[model samples]
Target: MLRFEGKVALVTAGAQGIGEAVARRIAAEGGSVVVTDLQEDRIKALAAELGDALAVRLDVTVRDEVDAAVAAAVERFGRLDVLVNNAGGCIVSTVPEDTSDSEWHRQLDLTLVGAARCIQASLPHLVQTRGNVVTISSVNGLAAFGNLEYAAAKAGQIAMTQNFAARYGGMGVRFNVVAPGTINTPNWDNQPDTLEKFKALYPLGRVGRPEDIAAAVAFLASDDASWITGHTLPVEGGVLTGPGLLDLTPTGPFRKDY
Candidate 1:
């Protein structure tokens, strides 16, 4: 249970959703956590909720903010052992033609480049403690998502993880990625059809829970995964195994769509 005992972790966008879940998991497993978010109020609230963890206001897209967040973590915890780059999201619709250049940049900033920036800011401290990095990318990173910009950005994060793992393994800083599929988060509140649609493709017959991804992240951050690096683990409930791109074919009476 105390897999992360004595470890200090920083989870970006940790105020809510997947990020929040990750922070809580780390704390539960005996790690001291620093929860960072752009929403100062929520960050403070979550920090209070996490008891011993620190709450930091950070906009991952801003280099200074990223640096400050990492500094705060190291300052409070005395050392940094894990960095969870979980703050990125699709800020706009994936309709490529309609997505403006700014939107594209924003998507990449929040999802891909944001992780890179956080990594850069934390690398020094990570190297000092032989820490690990767990980036929350998307299954779209490997497959095609019409949300071309988001997909591209997530893909970039995966590439960054692989390269960082290769370069930093020597420094005792390992890097790995966890790609979740159709997670049931606040973001999905806007998509009424997402659950029904996702269940059809997800072999597990349900949308993923934040805790599911969090468990995988904690393992990768723990010594159990010390030998694992440059790996992209899809916590997708078997969705990645088959042609999940298309919905299941309806049978007999269920063929209403047909």
Candidate 2:
């Protein structure tokens, strides 16, 4: 049951949502987890709940904070076995005509650059331990979405996965991406329309839960996925397979429009 027994894991943005779920899963699987997040109170509380975890305040975009967090992980756990770069999230943007330079840059910073910083901070430790990295990318990266900056950032993240895999696979380190589709996180609560749209588009008729992405993360971080690297695994419930009918047209009572 303890697939990651005796491993040392550092998860970025481990305070809530998919990141939190991944951290809990790692702990449950017998790994010593360092839950790093910018939200001190949330991570502190989470660390308390997950008795085997250590909480650290880390702003992945900040180099000093990134270094300190990594150092803390190594200091507390002796060695780092895995680095889960699960920190990035949606950075809202506007249409091409309205999009500002700062907004675009901010999206790239939060989604792509943040992941890059985490990887940079953890690379040496990962190389030392011959560990693995599981980055939480998005299906939006693989396909076109209206959110230009967010999609571009995610695509950059996926590219980074491949580059890292090629660069470090010989060093006994592995890198991979888990691209989830329309995950129902706290952000979904703020935008009810997104949830409805995702369910409409998804063949499974429901949006993804945090654990769905967490499960993929756990597998990728474990030795069980030893042969997998540089791969973008779509944990998207077949969203990439084909388009689902938004409305089947008069086939059901709920079918009101075309």
Backbone clashes in model 2, listed as residue pairs: none
TM-score per candidate: 0.92, 0.92
Worst 10 residues of 1 by lDDT: 249-258
lDDT of 2 at 146: 47
Clashes of 1: 0
Give me the runs in candidate 1 sitting further than 4 Å from their true place. 247-258
Compared with the true structure, what per-residue lDDT tens digits does model 2 show for residues 1-258? Answer: 799888999999988889999999988998889999989999999999888889999888788898899999999889999989888766664555687888888888888888888888888888988998889988778865446567788899999999999999999999999998777777667777646755766778888999999999999999899999999999987767746533323332112210
lDDT, candidate 2, at 80 = 92
lDDT tens readout by residue for model 1, 1-258: 999889899999888889989999999999899999988898898888878899999988899999998988888889999999998877675446788888988888788888999999999999999999999998878875445677789899999999999999998999999999878887768765756666776778887999999999999999999999999999988877855655434331112211
Instruction: Report the number of the highest-lDDT candidate.
Output: 1
Candidate 2 residue 9 Cα shift, in angstroms, is 1.0
Q: Which residue segments of model 2 deviate by more than 4 Å?
A: 245-258
